[model samples]
Target: MLELRPGCECCDRDLPPDSADARICTFECTFCVDCVDNVLRGVCPNCGGNFAPRPIRPASKLTNNPPSQKRTFNPDCFPASR
Candidate 1:
């Protein structure tokens, strides 16, 4: 299940679950559209991989499947040390 992160890690922009502006890398590193395209240049600053629009979790299931309580959003952690 997707954690449906609340905002961009770089700019701290609100990214509601249904937001079309949300982008995610393969490792689920979430960022805003502006950050993904302009600032990051389509390369995850942390992951070094391509990004895609994040999947929106249905609101109806909020009760059954709550969004993550994890408030941390550190893009620095997405890429594994090589």
Candidate 2:
């Protein structure tokens, strides 16, 4: 199951479970569209893989499988993994 991470790993932007702006790499490293497009250039800083829109879990399902409360932020701006 997707972790449904709560925030952008790059900018620490609040990415609520249903946010369309959330993008994720294969490793599920999450970032906002702004970071993916302008800052990261379509690349994931942690995993290097190109990002795709994170799937929005259905509201009904969110109750059963809630979004992750754990926030992941990488402030060091590490190079992309790939």
Candidate 3:
């Protein structure tokens, strides 16, 4: 089951479960679309791989398999400016 995180790890942006701007790596490391594209340059800071938009989990399944509400914010993972 995908653990739907609540916020962007980089900029601390709010990323609700249904947020279109939410991007995640294979490891489910979540980030905002802007942070992923502009700041991280599409490179996942934790996974070192490309990111894709997070799939929205259906509400029906949410009751049975609840998404994670835990926030795993990583503030020091931004790309270094040249």
TM-score of each: 0.80, 0.90, 0.88
Q: What lDDT score goes with residue 21 in model 3?
A: 94
Q: What is the model-wide C-alpha lDDT for candidate 1?
A: 0.79
Q: How close to the true structure is residue 22 of candidate 3, measured as C-alpha lDDT?
A: 95
Better of 2 and 3 by lDDT: 2
Model 3 alpha-carbon drift over 4 Å, by segment: none
Write the residue-wise lDDT of candidate 1 on 1-82 in tens digits.
8887788887777887779999988887889998887777789877689999997777898889876655546655333441
Off by over 4 Å in 1: 73-82
* lDDT score at residue 65, model 2, on the 0-100 scale: 96
**Model 2 Cα lDDT, one tens digit per residue, 1-82:** 9999999888899999999999999999999998888888997767668999999999999998999999988877644662
The candidate 3 region of ten consecutive residues with least summed lDDT is: 73-82
Candidate ranking (TM-score, best to worst): 2, 3, 1
- Per-residue lDDT tens digits for candidate 3, residues 5-82, read 889999889987778999999999999999998889999988799999999877787788777888888778865562
What is the full ranking by lDDT, best candidate first?
Answer: 2, 3, 1
- Weakest 10 consecutive residues, lDDT, candidate 2? 73-82
**Candidate 2, lDDT over the whole model:** 0.89
lDDT of each: 0.79, 0.89, 0.87
